[model samples]
Target: MNSKTVAELLSQDVTLQDVTVKGWVRTFRANRFIALNDGSTINNIQCVVDFENFDEALLKRVTTGAAIHITGELVESQGKGQSVEIVVKTLEILGDSDPETYPIQPKKHSFEFLRENAHLRTRTNTFSAVMRLRSSLSFAIHKYFNENGFYYMHTPIVTASDAEGAGETFKVTNLDIKNPPLNEDGSVNYKEDFFGKETNLTVSGQLEAESYAMSLGKVYTFGPTFRAENSNTTRHLSEFWMIEPEVAFMDLAGNMDLAEDFMKSVLSYILDNNRDDLEFLDKRLLDEDKTKPQAERSDMSLIEKIKFVVDNNFKRVSYTEAIDILRNCKPNKKKKFKYIIEEWGADLQSEHERFLVEKHFKCPVILFDYPANIKAFYMRLNEDGKTVRAMDILFPGIGEMVGGSQREERLDVLKEKMKALDISEEELWWYLDLRKYGTAVHSGFGLGFERLVMFATGMGNIRDVIPYPRTPQNAEF
Candidate 1:
């Protein structure tokens, strides 16, 4: 079979048959072996060449990152280490990469260095694996949504609504930042802004996606989302991606089920489709301990872990129960949290979220029904008058991978909640019009795309997964 995939070529029986392969040299060993890896997979296949047949001068010109094509006969290596090998008959240099200029080498380079060379970092084994997994998971997301009859909706990137509630937004202005139009009260006049009014990059597509879900039955949006938040923490990024699915006839329970199933599906697809890449990552970059602390290990062994999670059902719990358990924990017996979590009235911080998922639940936990006062104004109010219909799916290593809620369908209730939250009603006229025209009980949740990658690949930072990360004060590409 004619295939372009390196993974496929490695596994298939091509031994003693003429085949062509092209890739950059990851490593060269023993003056007779070339460790070749294409962007196709993480694992580099060993090509054993006889120095007697090939000119040493030509081989010497080929450095670490040089692109070359090999006409070879694949052979089963009974050698001590590798399973298979390729005996190269003809080696041709397609492109020569300068050894001094190529930033990536056989030696270990810092993550910060890789960030500076974001354009070239993809050639590295770790990044190649990450990008492959990323591409596979993205396809899996579409597959899961499409198979379930969910329409893939595209949401606008430039929006007037700042839905994240983070309050940190990048202003899209045509006027000069030094001196811009201002009202008599000295506030920036938004009326004259671009789009002929106030506008900013969208933080979430949930609001826009909701409008389509109400009519389309079930719809989802997957795209680039921007946040102007100034937080420089590893978990925070200015520009990221999100996958949000809204179901018109769904409630909080249905939303939870979708989140769990969606996550499992993505994990399962990566494990199945990218098994060789993941296996190489596990052997080279992942920690030696089966249960090692999360680190930047090249051998992430993600495929095995993903399969294990897919085979198991996620644990579910309520927010109220989690609070009670945290309060009674032996470690917290004498210690009070800074923003103390009381039984149904407080917000859950990352620490609390981490403690619950990593320590108590010991697996992926879907926690729901948080108090209305701490949640966004869009959430539906519960009968108890204290909590809203919201849920957050927390995983063992990453906390709050998904956050969503059942939107308030009642016009008056929504307006009341908006008023209490001190959100300007005038800014949300179009959003209100949806309820006036034809409102249906709908639910949706925003899955932080980077968080999903981090969880799936065991990458530590939000910055690592995204190319050219746009964190506060660090937009250098």
Candidate 2:
């Protein structure tokens, strides 16, 4: 018979049925219990082998982190603290892992230690759960986009223009490190670079996705994007994946709706499929208030808090009202704020976002019409001339997971904004030509893949969600 999944094997009512399972040993308890997991779900299947029948050599080979194939009899376990278990009939040692060398022991390992040993970190319980959830979320995103008539477009990792306008792009160059090309002014010679002009890693795929969206009607680009920002916080990563969706003939409200739908679909799918893994995370990772209710103690254990986001409509607020709310607040609430949300032009900090989502609104909040001076040059300017048509989706725990805007569709207006912002109008000629040829009202959003995973899994750090995080000075794995 083919190898049965742990989930399938556990759910059956039969006892003492023949079974085969292949996985790496997670823990070996009392020289009798072998906890094995195939990197399937977070939960591991316990294989109980009698001391006499268990081969000494085989048992020795089945060290922690060793890959093993086990032939066993499935039984409804009543002994110890397990629900379902397998009684080993014959055990095969697939691969041996030296206990002395393996870093991921049964003992508790810190996140910092795990970051160092990035290659082996995936074998740990937390990382395993995160990896599974990440895979499921990726599938969920593709499924949602495909079902909703969205074409998946692959955008270039390298681009002439840095989409975010944040000036944190990692430069790509072919100049020799020892004796690099120099200009007459003693500056780095970009003309000698591979692209002729200056080129760098793309910060966002929104612009390229927008081009496809204009022609394809609806398109999304899902891939890795890099940034050289020197942020060492749990939220920032040097390299991370992004899911950017751009749609033509879509305004700000329509864009918000798409974001809401996309988030809901992905969350709902992961909550449904990865209940076991998520439940393990909830009990292990989340706060006490986030724990599942007694009535919903089994089925909906994974995503008790997320149901509110999926079921209810999000609260929408403009930048103007957000400032007023922050300014007119009582003295007690004023002291709680890290940075005072004084005016409309100020960038909304994480504190402000959290206040709106967690305290004031008590739901997900969509803040739109951000100040033009603070936003990118390509955003459509509002009539007030102070703000632009940008929007950010703020959740309870994680703030600003999705930041996007309606692109300025007029050639003249875009040019003027580019000039005012001191951006290179020559470099953006192709982008401006898009507006001149046939520009339809379009909108899109960039959902940080790590942030989404962080929100979904209740994992606090962006690094915890990504396998090998590329933070500044921390690229060991």
Candidate 3:
């Protein structure tokens, strides 16, 4: 017989006919009921077994994490929570899982514990829901951009340049560490490497996306990005996905509008299509928050926060204005902030950003015109020469959900900025050619895909949202 997923079976009326289902057993209760899930949905379909007819050894194999195939008849469930269930006529153990050794069991496990067993964490309810929402949001991003006259460009995962200029890049090389090709200056010869030059995993696709945007009018890149920063925080990941959209002839204001609209559209799509998963996550977050202090708990539920963002306009503020607020804010005033905002050029830390978005603005905030020294060289320089036309969209919990800016179109200014920042002119000649020939004002922003998933799923850690989180000293999975 054709196999039907648990989600499909649960959604329809009981047919009172035979149905074949294949899935991993979530739990085997009293050797009679098996909670089966096949990753179709968060909810599991209950499969009741006729233990009297089954062999004792066969029934013993129906432990948690075991893969099984069951031929059964769909009928109305007597259980309180589920509406329907399967009455199994015959059961076949496709794969047996010993409860003594299976890492994931039918119990609550810490996110840290789950991180160690990243390969099997999806068997749990939380990770599965998060991954599902992540998938939905990914689709929504492409759909939103495609429907809005934007071309999806596939950017290279490996590149010769560091787009962010952070210097924390994972070097990609195929050289013998013990005895590598050396140069006359006693330096490792990168010319002998695979690409004939020093290369690394791309830090961002924005540079490449900008080139396409200039000619294509608008383009977006969604792909993996790498960073070698050794920060072991819940929010930092060594390798993650980024969604960057660059548009030609767009200024700072237009860029802000595009980002806000894009975020709302994607969030709305998830709310509509993945309500079940969101609901599950929402409840999970609420339950998790009960153990925390009252002030530490979220002001609104997960769904409420998402809906608030979707329905409300993002409060726009200038970096100068944000600086004033941060300096005068209670945290800075009381010296509670780890990094105090004392002056105009100081970069805003996570605490400061949270205060602006959560405490002061009480909504999503867009802070623009950041100090030039604190921003990237690509951002357009302002008249004052002190700040650049950069914008960061800050969410309530997530510090900076999106970072973008209006690109400096003037060739002379761009070259000067690049030289001042010590960026190689010859290496980026192709990028410079874009500005030299026909560079019109272009703008774009990068949204960390994992951070977006964390926001949508109410998952606290960046590690939990990504399947195999690549972090410093932790690449087991």
Q: Which stretches of candidate 1 lie over 4 Å from their true place?
A: 1-4, 184-186, 283-308, 334-344
Which residue pairs show collisions in model 1? 15-74, 281-299, 281-300, 282-301, 285-297, 285-298, 285-299, 286-299
The CA lDDT at 427 in model 3 is 88
As for candidate 2, its clashing pairs are: none
Model 2, 245-364: lDDT tens digits are: 999999999999999888888999987898877887887754443465764233232375577678768888998898888777763255767786555578878878877787788788
TM-score of each: 0.91, 0.93, 0.97
TM-score of 2: 0.93
Separately for all candidates shown, the number of backbone clashes (residues 3 or more apart, or on different chains) is: 8, 0, 0
By TM-score, the candidates rank as 3, 2, 1
Against the true structure, candidate 3 reaches a TM-score of 0.97
What is the C-alpha lDDT profile of model 3 across 1-477, one tens digit per residue? Answer: 889988899898757888999999998898888999999999999999888989998998899999999998899998888988999999999998988999998888988899889999999999999999999999999999999999999999889999989999999998998999999999999999999999999999999999999999999999999999989998999999999999999999999999999999999999899989999999988998998999789988999989978988999999999999999988899999999888888988888998998889888999999989989999999999888999999987778899999999999999999999999998899999999888799999999999999999888888989889899998885
Q: Candidate 1, residues 258-322: lDDT per residue as tens digits?
A: 98898888888887788766776665444444456554222224555565457667678888888
Q: What does the lDDT come to for candidate 1?
A: 0.80
